[model samples]
Target: MNIKELQQYVSRFCDEKGFEGIPLETRVMYLISEIGELTDDLLEIKGATTEKQEVIKRNIGHEMFDVTWNIFDLANKLDIDLEAAFKEKMNINENREWKT
Candidate 1:
């Protein structure tokens, strides 16, 4: 699904899960927690020496979804179009020169 569809899906899921009452600050905190989980997964993968790499990667994906879900939900609550904002930000980045 595209961003909008995913946003809708997540919104519905959040609603059904009784997450609709979460405040913006709570969402931000949850997103931050998910980021920490993702970071831990990444660090494990970077230092991995076993066959659990795939498991860690899967965990990382889950963490990423958690972050994105909160982002979409919060954006919806704030009436912000994340897709547009993302595209606009990318346009600016695409036009800028790298500082290599």
Candidate 2:
């Protein structure tokens, strides 16, 4: 499904499960955790870092999805339209982007 559908799906999931919504701070924390996990996996796979960097790389895709889940969760909780949001913000990004 597309981003809009996925956002609705994740939001519905929380509602259907009788789950309380996560706070924005918690969602951000999860995002950071997922990024750290991805970084550790990359470092390990490249053999460019310490053994301490050897986090379980196999499940990073799941972690990434989980991060999106929380993001959509928080956005839906706050009644944000992510599609329009991104489209609106793209103007700023486009102007600031360097030519590849």
Candidate 3:
């Protein structure tokens, strides 16, 4: 689903999960923790045996989803349009000079 729809879904979930009253800063900390988890999985993947690699890969994917879920929830709580912001940032990046 698109970000807007996913944000709405997360909003409904927050209500059900009682996360609607959670502080913005706390939500941000949760997001940071998810990022750390993702990093840990990446490190594990680097040294994983072939069979273990699949499990680590799935863990990494799940961690990444958690990161995005937190991001969407935070943006919804703050009334930010992430899709719009991402597009605007990409447009700005498209015009920047870069070293070869």
Candidate 4:
């Protein structure tokens, strides 16, 4: 689904799960924690044997999704439209030059 849809879903989930009471600072902390988890999953997969990597790969997607969900939740809590923000950022990037 698109960013907007995903944000809406997370908002609804938070409301249903009583996570609406969570403060923005806590949300930011959670997002950071999820990022760490995702990084750990990536590192595990990278260093694992082929067979073990396959097992770790399965958990990697969930970690990635957790990161995305936390980001969307943070955006929602801050009342930011991630889809619009993303598009605006991309437009600015397209015209910008990068030093390689």
Candidate whose lDDT is highest:
3
lDDT of each: 0.88, 0.75, 0.93, 0.90
lDDT of 1: 0.88
Please give, for residues 1-100, the per-residue lDDT of candidate 3 as tens digits.
Answer: 9877888999999999999999999999999999999999998898779999999999999999999999999898889998899899999999999899
The reply for model 1, stretches above 4 Å from the true place, is: none
Model 2 residue runs over 4 Å out of place are: 48-58, 97-100
What tens digits encode model 1's per-residue C-alpha lDDT throughout 1-100?
Answer: 8988888888899889998898999989998988898898898897776678888888888999988988899898898888888899999999799878
Span of ten consecutive residues with least summed lDDT in model 4 = 38-47
Worst 10 residues of 2 by lDDT: 48-57
Tens-place lDDT digits, model 2, residues 1-100: 9889998898789889965556778768877887787666665666544453344454556667877887787788788999889998897788795769
lDDT ranking, best first: 3, 4, 1, 2
TM-score of each: 0.89, 0.69, 0.91, 0.92
